[model samples]
Target: MNHSNLKIRARDERILVIDDDLGVGECIQCMLRIAGYESAFVTTAAAGLERAQSEAFDLVVSDLRLPDRSGIDVLRALREAGQDTPVILMTSYSSIESAIEALRTGATDYIIKPFNNDDFLYSVERALDEQRMRKENAMLKRSLKRVYSSRRIIGESEGILRVLDMIRRVAASDANVLIEGESGTGKELVAQAIHYASPRAEGPFVPINCGAIPAELLESELFGHAKGAYTGAVAASEGLIREASGGTLFLDEISELALNLQVKLLRVLQERQVRPLGSKHTYATDARFVAASNRDLKQAMEQGLFRADLYYRLNVITIHVPPLRERGRDVEILAQHFIEEHSRRLGKRITGMSPAMRDFLYSYHWPGNVRELENLIERSVILAEGSVLSLEDPPAKGTTAPAPGTAGEFLDRPLPVEEYMKEVVRRYQDSHSEMELAAMLGVGRKALWMRRRRWGLYRSGDSRREGTGKGDLKRSA
Candidate 1:
C-alpha cells in the first residue's frame, strides 16, 4: 500500500518514531512527512528516550520490542522523567501482552505489526488527536486559574479585601467553610473561588441551592439512591456529594434545610459517609463542604428553625461579604464598571454619565447591592437613546444628607441668599427670558424684572425705556 498519500493535518506537530528496523522507521517517517508532520526516526530505544527527554514532541510512536530495551521500559522512563508526550506502541501478533503492558505503563495506543497502511495512519491520527486535546485542556486549565486568581472576588473595599484574604488563607486547608451574606451579595461566587483556589482545584465544584429542592428529594440528591429506592426510580445514580469527591460541594441557602435533612447532613459531615435512599450500603465521600446562608444561622438556631450542631460543624471557617451600600466608594466604582460592561454588551457607544446622573448614582442608596446595581446599569444601557444618559428623576432625599447637627448649623448661618440669587440670575440670564424666570419662580414678570434690577443683573436684550418701571426705580439707586 502506498501510504505516502496520507497527509498530517497539523503541520507544526512534532512526532518521534522509534523502531529497531531501519526500513520500518524510515517508511513511517516518510509517511508522516507526507502527512505534513515534522518527524524524526530513531532505531534504538535509548536514542528515542534521549530525544524525548531533551526535546518536545507532540507524539511518540515506538515498537514494542527493541534490540536494547522494550517500549514498556521507554514508556516508564518517560513517565518517571515527567515527559507526558503521548506514546503509541507497535508490536507483533505474538507480543500483544507486551503491548498491553506498555499501555498500562502509559502508552496512549497500540497497533499490531504487518498492519494495513490505513490502519497504521488511523492509529497515528488518533494518538495525535488525543495529544492535541490534552494540550488544549491544559491551556484551558491555565486560563481558568488566571481568571480565578484575579477576578474571583469582586469588590476591593476594605471589608471585601479582608474577606478575600480570609478565603485565600482558608482555601489551602480541608476545613469546612460557611459563607454568610445577604442575598445578591455573591455568596456562591465566594464559594466557587474558594474551591478553585484550594488543593482540590482539579476536582469538581458542585453547587446546590438547598431551598430550591424539596425535602423528600433533598436527601436523595445529597446521598445516592438505589435503582428501586422509590416510585419512578429506574436507575442507580451517584449523588452530588459523591460527584464532588476530591473537590467542594457548595450548599447555597443552607438555612432552608429541614431538621431531618439537617441531621442527615450533619452525619455526612461527621462520618464522611453517605447511605443512599433505600440502599442497604453506604459509600464514603471526600468532598470538602462549603455551605452558604443569607440568614443568620445562629438566630435561626435560637428560633428553633435550624440545627445548632450542624451550624457549628459548618462554621469552622466563616466569610462575610459586606453589602454594596456599606462598601464605601465601591458603589460608584462598581456602577461605572457595570455601565461599561453593559454598554459593550448592548453595542452602545455611551460616552459617560451626565452631572445629574452622576449625582444621582452617588447619592442614591443601593438597597439590593452590587447585583441590583448591575441590573439597573443593564437597563439604562438598553434604554439609552443618546450619548448622554438622561436622569429620570433626582436621587431620593436623605441619601446624601450631612451628618446630624451639621445641617442645622448650615441652614441657620446662611448669609448670602440675595447674593446667591444674583449669581443664579446671572448664570441663567443668557438662556432664560424674563417671562421664563417669572414662570419658574411662580411670580409676575414685573416682579422678576424688579428682582433682577435690585440684584444689578440685567440681560443684554432688556429695554431702556424711561418709564417708572421696576428696572428704572431700582436703577435710580
Candidate 2:
C-alpha cells in the first residue's frame, strides 16, 4: 500500500504482538512501525490477553507456545471476552493437526516459522483488511437495529405493516417523499425510519417544523443566511437544507408554508441550488426532501392556498400514515409498548394493563392520535402502584364513560358535535382552574376568556361563574 493510505489506516489501527521470543516480537513491532502501523508487543500471553480485553485492537499476532498458556487458549479467552480481532498464529512445529487446530480455534492464518519478510507483511495486511470489513459489517447491523426498533414507529396492525413495507422499499431510492397523516400521528418517526434505512444512513437527518417558525425567518431557516442578512445576523449560518446535504430534510406541517416561500422551495427542488439570504452567490445542495402535513394539499390547491406545482413536486412518492382509531387492536398494542417503555425508564415494575384500561384504549376515538395515547400511557405507567395498570378514568378528553345499560360498556355512542363540545367545555370547567384549562386547550388566557364570551358560558365581569351549563348536563346525563 501507498504511504498515505497506510498513514490513514494507522490513525485508527492498533495491533498486538505476543511472543516469548524477544527477537521475534521486536522484529514484528519494528516492521509494523515502519509500515505506519501502531502496535504493542508483550512477552507473555497473560499480558497480551489483558491488553486485548482492556483495549481495542485491529489485529493480533501470537506465537503458538507461550509461558503462561497455549496460543489456542489465548484465542479462546479473547473470543469468550467478545473480542473478534483477527489473530495470526506463528510456530516452528507446523504439524497438520496443530495447524488445523489453530485454524479451527479462530486463527485468521497459521504461519510456519522462518517465514520471509514479504510473506509476513502480506499476512498482516490481509488480517487488518479482514478486521476492517468485519467492523464495517457490525456497524451496518447496528444501524439496521436502530431503524427497525419499535420505538420509532409504533403499530403492528396490517395497515401499519403495509406502510413499513412501503417505507423499506422506497428507502433505497432518492425520491422526494410526501407523508400525509393527521396531526400527532408520528409522521416524523416514519421520516426517521426512512432516512436511517436508506444508503445515506450515516448522514444527518434534519427535521424542521415549518409551522412553528415565523414567516419572516422561515426562508433563512430553510435556505441559510449570509453574514448581516437581517437585523440580528451576526455571521453566515447554514440552514437545514445545507446542513442536510447528501442526507434527508424533513419539513413537518409543510402546508403551513406561505405561497411565496413555496415558490422558492420549488425552485430549490428544481435547480438543486440555494441562494442564501443577503447573498448573491448560489450554492449547490443535494438534500432529499420529505414533506409532511395534516392538511389536504389537494384541497389547499383547489382553495388557492397552496401552489399546484409545488404540491406535485413534493408528492412524487407519497405515504399515508393511518390514524390510531383506524388501526383496530393496534391501539392496545401501542399502549402496551408505551407502558413498557415508560415503566423501564421510570424504574417501575408495571406488569400489564387492566381489562377496563384495555377497553377504554380500544374504544376511544383518539382524536389526537398516537401522540396523545403515548402521553396517556406514560402518565398511567408513572401513576400505577401495583402490577396492573389502573385506567378506569381513561384520559381527560377520551369519551370512555360507561353507558347506562351495558355491564362493561365504558362509554355510550359518540355524541353530536355541539353536545360533545359542550361536554368537553363542562369537563374543563369542573376539573381544572382557568389557567389549567387554557393550557390544556393550547390557548392563551385571553383567548380562553374570549371563547367564554362567544359561548356565553359566563358573564364578562364575574370571576366565580364556573358552573356546568344545561347543554353540558344534558349531554353528560
Candidate 3:
C-alpha cells in the first residue's frame, strides 16, 4: 500500500489515539501527524473519553484491552454520548467472539497489533471513507428537508384537498404510487408531499425526470454504473436507487422510458433489487417508488408507446391531479397565496387583486394548470403598479385571462395581422359572439371565422366568454 497516498485522507481530519502504553500512543500520534493529520495521544480510557467528548475528532483509534477499561466500553460510552465518529480498534490477538462484539458495537474497522504500516493505514483509510459517506448522506437529508418544507402543497379546493387526503392514506404504505396529470399540475409537488409525509420521511427523496435525460443516459442515472462500465466511465457511483434506499424515488414522466429500460425497471420492482449498468452484483433496494406522467400511460400502452406490464407495475396506486381549471376556487386561493409569498420576496406592499380579477381567474380554462397560475401571479406582483393587482400591469393582455385596459390600442392600430388578431381574440373571446367579435374588430365575419379555425382558440359549442350574453355581438364588420 502507498503510505504517501494515505497522507491526503487525514489532512483535514482530527484523530484520537487511545492506549496506556506511552510508546505505542506516541508512535501512532507521530505517524498520524506526519501523514498530515492532527491527532492526540491518551494514556487511559477515561482521558480518551474526556478528549473525545470535549473536542472534535474525525476518527478514533483505541486498543481493545485498556489498562482500566476495554475499548468496547469506550466505544459504547462515546456512542451513548451521541458521538458517531468512526473508530478503529487495535488488538494483539482476539477471539472470534471478541472481534464480532467490536463490529456489532459499530467499530468501523480493526487492526492487529504490530500491524504492517501499510495495513494500519489501509484500515484507517476505510474507516474515514465510511465516516465521510455517513456525514454526506446526513447533510443531503437536511438540505432536502429544508428545500421541500417551504414548497407546501397550497390548495383548499375539493379536488386538491382530496388529493392531499389520498396522499396521506397511501404515504404510510410501501406500495408503488402513480401520479397522472397534465403537465404543470404540480405532479412533482405531489410526489414530494408523499415522500415528506411518509414513514420513511427521514430518508432521502430522489427525483429524476425521465423525459429530461437522454435515453442513452437515463438508465445509468436511475440505476447507476460501475467503474469502467462504459466509455467516459471514470468511477463507480450509486444511482437514485441506493441514494433513496430508505426513502422514495420519484420518476417523473415515466411514460418516456424506453421499453427495454422499462423492462429492467419492472424486474427491479418485482425482485426489489437493482443492478447498476456495467456492474455484476445486484443491490437490494427498500426505496418506495413514486412515478408520475403527464401523458396517459394506458393510452401510450395502447399505441405501443409504453409497455402494459410496466404500466401496471407503476399503477399500483394511482393519483390523478385535476388540472387547475377543475379545482374550483383553488385558482383564487393560489393567486392570493402567491401574492403574499412573492410580496414578501420582492418586498412589495401588494395586498390582493380585484374581485372581478379573482372571478375572472376562476372562469378561464387554465390549460397550463397550477404552474401557469403561479407564474402569472408572480409576474403580476412584480410588474403590478398598485397594491391591488389588475390585468393591465405586466401588460398581461391577450392571455387566457381578461385584459381590461389594452383594447383601444389593440383595436386602433394596424399591428401585425396575427398579433392583432390574437390580442383581439384574447381581449374579447370571453365577452363576444362570433359575429359581434368580428364587428368589433372591423373584420369580415368570414375572416374572423377563418381565424378561429386556424388558431383553434375555441370549439364551436364552447362558450367564447364567461358571462351570459349582456349584449348581442355585432353581426356585420
Q: Which candidate number has the best TM-score?
A: 2
lDDT (Cα) of model 1: 0.75
Error of 1 at 80 (Å): 17
Candidate 3 off by > 4 Å:
1-151, 399-477
Model 2 regions more than 4 Å off: 1-138, 145-151, 392-477
lDDT of 3 by residue, 1-477 (tens): 223444544378889999988888887877787677889898789999999989999999999999889999999999999899998999887789889999999999877788766678778778888889988997787657645643567777788878888887997898899999876688988898888767787888899988768789988888989999999989997888888999999998898799899999999999999999999999999999999987778889999999898888888899998877678877888888889999999999999998767766865555456766776787778888788987666425543333544454544444543565567676676656675455444344555665665665653355444343333333322
lDDT of 2 at 130: 85
Q: How much is the lDDT of residue 83 in candidate 1?
A: 82
Q: Give every collision pair in model 3.
A: 430-465, 436-473, 436-474
Better of 1 and 2 by lDDT: 2
Q: In angstroms, what RMSD does candidate 3 have relative to the true structure?
A: 14.6
Encode model 1's per-residue lDDT on 190-232: one tens digit a residue.
8888887777877899999887787888888988799999998
Clashes of 2: 2
Root-mean-square deviation of Cα positions for candidate 1 versus the true structure, in angstroms: 18.9
- TM-score of every prediction relative to native: 0.60, 0.63, 0.59
Once fitted onto the true fold, the runs of candidate 1 whose alpha carbons sit more than 4 angstroms away are: 1-90, 94-106, 111-140, 145-149, 393-477
Q: What's the lDDT of the predicted structure labeled candidate 3?
A: 0.79
RMSD of each: 18.9, 14.5, 14.6
